[model samples]
Target: MTRPNRPVSTVRLAGRPTQRSALRRATQIAMALSGFLLWVAWHRGLMRCDTHRAADRFAEVLQRLGTTFVKLGQHLSLRADILAPDAQEALASLQANVAPFPPEQAVQEVEAALGRPWQQVFARFDMHALAAASIAQIHRAALPDGTEVVVKIRRPGAAEQAETDMRILRRIVLVMQGLVPSLRRWGLAAIVDEVAANFRYEMDLSREAASVRRFADAWRGSADIVIPDVVDGLCTPTVMVQQFSHGAHLHGLPSSTAVAAAGKLVDSYVAQIFRDGFFHGDPHPGNVFVMDDGRICLHDFGIVGRVDGNMRRALVAFALAFVEQDAEWVVDAWLDLGLLGDGTDRAVFVPVVRALVADCAQRPLKDWSLSGALAQLVAAGRTQEVRLPRDLLVLTRTLLLLEGTVRLLAPEFSIIEAISRHTTTGVFDEPKSAASQRLPYELGNAAHALPSLLARRLHSVLRQGDLLQLSIKPDARMLSGIDRLGRRVALALVTLGLYIASSLLMQHGVGPRWGDMPVLALLGYALAIRFTFSIARSRG
Candidate 1:
């Protein structure tokens, strides 16, 4: 997703002192710590939020932490399997309720981004903001052509503040890792990097406009969903203008109506992810609205995802493996996606995956908890030395979010069942026979990849044919062992020489009896080092 460079209204921040920012961060940390301490102090007492029906309190705390933390909470909210349902629902509210900047700042942002007066750009623009969030705020405007639209204005220094908060978050993650080694397998660092990368893209409004156009074009004829038309001339890096949308927020919609709408939405989103390999990465309820006619209008194309052909195939394989109850195939799919550790023992991993699948199958997905699944999966992965990739975790979050949103409409809907029905009907699978008939569809996808693949192949051919090549004659492994042994022997010899020199100097009364223990200690150390190395060498 892209953001605009110009904001509707600008509030030039007086270069706030570094101390001010530090103080703000310190204050946030102190508040967070205070909350944690209060929770701990009453964790087993009557006032514990976890024990009481007080999910709202936890959500309130997360929102108070500001953008980065709110985003993290939104991510956590996706894990319906792990978090209590009440808490997840509360956190979902943050998708739209996070703090907003002033409308004057938004107008200034639009003016600065467009490099012209707001009046010159839009025939009539409302100064009041329609909505505000951590990243940007929305305003209503009318174009010279008499078309009504909404403009999204990126907040001033939003990107810089997000980056700062992310750095602080990294430290928090590092501390968490130290306290919990199992976190290493989660690839939290990579997750943070991905979130940062996507958020950076979101900070650019132009990119969001382009992505919105892309989605609009891709789903042009789709009746179940709507992607707003981008107001090309009115868009900038700091601001984006799109066709005005009208719909009831998801929470306000009837459950049955929401379910039907959500089902189609899920189907469309899954198709985009699995079949088209391009997906809107963020699908929070706030980014989605249900029109009066039952069409789902997706907003904020700030975070999209793309999977390569190979990864798409692996995903298909994973689904197939799930259907077939093939543990080996599941493991293979995991490996295909680079979700396994180098030292992982296949023997142990295969059965673990099989057991996990069986356990998962025994329960309906609607009842699944992300945290519980992770705990089980992580426990198994550690025992089997499997390491799940960060992206897969995000993918898991994506699915959970989709499922949660779907449940908001239809509480009893079964994701696995839906997937099975689709797969079995060949809705997701394109048969070879169909490929022959649908050559255009196949070619369209191929055309996207052919250029890069051809270039890579040609470059590889040229490199092998003419590029300089150097060959080494030494046996690399053998040479490495020899080098290591030589270093150890040389160090031992030097130590002996030093010990002798020190002893002589002491004998000549140039030094005290410090030479006695020092020389003996050096010799003993050398002998111990040699003994340990020999033992390891012998074992090998």
Candidate 2:
């Protein structure tokens, strides 16, 4: 699934900012943000846009400002909890509805990117962009051979504008750090970093071209899925040419063939993740189209995901464990994926996951989803101050969107049933119960009897001089414990030393008095206070 970027007319890569220009831009950003915040407070409540009018107002301003501001709005639209539904809707419109650049400028961009005249490269090219977005615009064009294709041109100055905007954002984050004091810990900084990466990635058309070819290869010879063929000869760092594919949005409404279409999409995505290990990161309806021939057309390869063998296996184990209601296995799989943070309590985490899975599994497959379950797991992990890998967050969001998209199209679709399509594909060995796989299998009665006989003989044969070797890597929990203990011990030793020095100085009266106290004693007490304060700060 793919969501288009913010709409823009022109995006030239900008030049370095002079001090005066930087100051002017900084002033503009401050004034705009302050006005927006003040307007929000008057029109809505704190931290949320409660009414449609407020949502519309905030959205209108961001859209008018354009570029990075609009991009930020697009991201905010996904945060339903912080914004009211109407607000989310209002911001989402910016994704595809922002103002388009002049048609002549779009043509110039294409010509410059290709390093050739427009007529030479395209037999017939549409002057008007098919679509305009924050980073780039798409135009319908035909190659010299008359093959139908879509050309994506990077918006002039888009890169420079984004860079300038991110610098301003970091300044805002720094300001927040002083006020809220835990904004970084809240992961807002991480979110901004991802946004920066996301925008940069989308701007690189050559990267997107490569991903298109990769997806095409992954589904080579497949009839159920369509990946547009990239015209690499015409592709450039700022421009991409690829085959055009069409399909219905197929969201919130599904035709009679929807069940089959939804099933195929789900099956293909599961393979992309668990089997092929490369997937589309954003799977919204806008990124996917249903061909008239019942084949699904996947689009927007700017943000594809790749999973190595170990991660793929771990994800499979996690999904199966969830379906099987195996809490321990779920914890283990999360541990394998590095989703759980340090000091995660297995006892508490196991029960929480089991309860959540049990409640979710109570619903029929048609009404069930892993999204809520995953959200709960993530929230629980956060309580322990566990730091999860950022990539896991992206993957979870992608899968959650995919699940919703599939269900929206076909309400009765079953993900499990769809996964069976590749049961024979050998992405995984035949699945078995975790318990059975973890333990040696029981064979015959002779095998069962041999274990007890061997135990008695081994005990008898064990002697004082017998050699037994065992080696195990250190546990994470053990290491964390040692680290904390070391810090505390160091603090305690320093505190004791300070106390002794202060007592000795007081007894001996070693230096000039400060009121009734010796200078040496006063210095020792001051050092102790500083040390104690440092220790407290570290713990906090």
Candidate 3:
């Protein structure tokens, strides 16, 4: 099946502004954003202003500022902790609609990326773009063998522009944080750093290609969902070619088809998070399509999220607790997830969460909204100074986007019910019996090693003539401090081990390589760094 080419609005590519230096870029940003910054200072420091109006103006400025700022605004819209409801709503409306660069430029880009004439690669290449966004534009094309594919070309000067924008954004964040001490707690600088990283990832088409391949591998035999296959030997940093997915957008499907598609969508997402731990982060309506064969096709793999084992378990517990209307358990789950801040007032936080649970429980399945409820919970947490993990926030945004698409197809679809079914059906349930069966063997192994461990320790103490002196009074506070120190030491040791192993892997060229380094080595380094920061944060 092939999708018809649609007319896309084209504009002469007025490329990104080239700034000579960071200072020059910073100056330009200041001039562009001075009004909004001053308004924020006055509103926050002096008389309060209407946040809705302020949010509208902020969105307008971001939209006018170009791609990087629009992306930042979209990210900020997901932060329920930092923004008011009205502000979130306003920012959520920010779209990345832009005129497509001329087809000649796209042709030049593809030929350059391929290092060959365009006719050698494609039997037919559409001049008109299939779609255009801030980061890239998609065009319909066909291989020499007549295999239908889509070509995605990165926007000209996007990388340089993003780099410049991010530098200026960091400076702005630093200035804002210094001016308002309270802004430090919100981690504005950290947010900018994260946005910069994600933008860089998106700019690298090879990463998105890898993501699509990974998803396809994960769902290789799935009958209900379809992932487009990437064209091997064609993907590069600025260009990607993939099988063209053919289906009607979700809104265009018939009611029955849409409802079935909705069910498949919910099931696929549940499996992605609970079973696979990796999922498409942005599953908005435009990215979802209902196939003529009643299968669901997911497009756009640029943004995705991963759930670690701990987060998956916490989410399962949270879903079960929410289903049972056990607010205390919900709070416990959040605490277990390490979302509650040190200054969180449990007395107030509990009541707020309890009320939200009560309200959700009272509503009919069709009327209930998992995303809205979660958003409200996040907002409530914000009020009590609770902080949520970025992955959780991303998941919340994913659910919000999924719900909107689902509603268009099946207005009565119950996300809560779908979650409950998945959780209770052993899809996410751990095998308790298997763990119980392994307990005896684990204990026997531990018991067998205990005497050896004890002998070594005892011999060391005896050799040092400290065996008798080892007996000492145990103070509660002292023991607690020692326990904390021991945990930190263990964590530090593990982190060191990971770094060493990763370095060895990199040196030996072990495992699959991404770019210059081994993928596993890269993962090991990332995990090690995360642990290092965790240790630092705990000490602080």
Candidate 4:
């Protein structure tokens, strides 16, 4: 029920609305945002003045405002780059749980989505909600065939309200960006837009059905874990139905069961992150339930996170660096991950990073200065005015959650130990040579070679001036390659020139006319289009 993500939606209003519709949306947004602000003001006296308290306050406000804002809060929880840790931590409550909407409205939503009365759709449809949440409510029911299922019904008017709220937030964020320049650096507008996309995805329940189906396909025949199967011919934009897991909730599971469950959860995440490069975005205890037979059931697909191949490699590098206690390796991993920019002050940054690695290495998992190594690294980056990417931040938050839950169930378990065992394996494909492992230390120990290396490099630099190198374009052996490149360049230039000439000829009707346009120009246009696609196909 807490599936929400990305903040980019603030600026992304749905539809090319008429002026009246725009005005109506604007008014709705204004009223909604204002009410949220009022709630914040009222709660401030009992809250801390820092960003953490502010975040908790914001979530409270969103819950009060209803589904759209609550959904927004859930997305905000993942945007660690945009918000401080305290704020992110506070927003996580949205993912943990949301207040239930009334049961009668849930029935209406089901009826509206299915285009029939609940009685017709199911042999026994439960009017009472099994669990109620911001976006949707879950209810236990059975088909005429006696197949048990849970129907997820979106809150009525969620889409319309989310769009309005997103639009209003966009306008407000833009205004704030202009008025308070610091806000622009945080990419608040982009964050809001992402949240809008998340809301939009969740608002369309069919997408969730597809996501679960794909997840199931990915893990086919895996007996250790379970992803609920979607009900065929039973999904709409506002509602979806999936086969329910007859399992104990995570809260009710014994600690002994939890220990085993935690290990399964970690292994599942490893498969999702390392093998497939796609994963369930939020793997907190709330989204997990343990069956009596001990199989783990994962719920919610609207907020899955994806890391492409390159990012997965970077994560592997980071994990390896931590295992080796190579501070420089971790720093390099951060740079490769785009969490630290080229312009960052590495001289000042290195010591701060080394200290962080040292501190985490020396401390207990529960006593780490920040949530975990990743969070502390991000925190250090924040201190040095560096910005981490949103994807890595989400991964960090995810790993931290996993670590906490694992510890609760099995205090003796260590994800770090698991990571060290896997880092040297082919699972992640990272360079595992001793040279790669001790690269920074090798450089550090080779201080005597620095002067000779610099002298040789400087001599080479003096020998090959930039202008001198450019003057010698194509060497004799490379002439064929150069010729091929030249042909591509010539083709591109010719296509552009022909395109311009055709447009001019058609505009002035300068050549033989066909349908009041120049036939020669038409021919030229056709030639340009053909060549353009030819070039694209060749590249592809």
Which candidate has the top score in TM-score? 3
Per-residue CA lDDT of model 3 for 1-540, tens digit only, reads 222222222222345655565568677678778888788778866867644367777887777676678878888887887788878877777776678988999999999999998999999999999988888999999999989999999988777778888988898889878988988988779888888888899999999999999999988878899999899999999999999988887766777887789899999998898888899999998888887888889999988988887887888887788777788987777667658477766566588677887787678977767677678778878776676777788888999899888888989888778777875578778534567989999999999999999999999998989867747798999899899999999999999999999999999999999998899999999999999999998892
Better of 3 and 4 by lDDT: 3
lDDT of 1 by residue, 357-435 (tens): 7787788665644333333444555554455554565566566667667777677876666666677555467534555
Q: After superposition, how far is residue 341 of candidate 3 from its true place, in Å?
A: 3.8
- Regions of candidate 2 where Cα sits further than 4 Å from its true position: 1-21, 32-65, 76-96, 247-256, 347-352, 385-387, 420-425, 430-540
- In terms of lDDT, the poorest run of 10 residues in model 1 is 1-10
The TM-score, computed over Cα atoms with residue i paired to residue i, of candidate 2 is 0.71
On residues 13-37, what C-alpha lDDT tens digit does candidate 2 reach at each position?
Answer: 3446667877787778777767876
Cα misplacement distance, residue 348 of candidate 3 (Å) = 3.3
| Candidate 3 lDDT | 0.83
RMSD, each candidate, Å?
A: 10.4, 8.5, 15.2, 14.3
Cα-based TM-score, every candidate = 0.64, 0.71, 0.77, 0.68
Which candidate do you rate higher for lDDT, 1 or 2?
Answer: 2
Tens digits of per-residue lDDT for model 4, 224-254:
8888899888998878999988677666567
List candidate 1 segments past 4 Å from native.
1-17, 27-31, 34-63, 76-100, 169-198, 247-263, 290-295, 340-387, 410-418, 421-540
| Ranking of predictions according to lDDT | 3, 2, 4, 1
In model 3, where do residues sit more than 4 Å from their true spots? 1-24, 40-52, 431-540
lDDT of 1: 0.69
Candidate 4 residue 374 C-alpha distance from true site, Å: 1.4
What shift in Å separates residue 392 of candidate 3 from its native position after superposition? 0.9
Predicted structure 4, TM vs. truth? 0.68
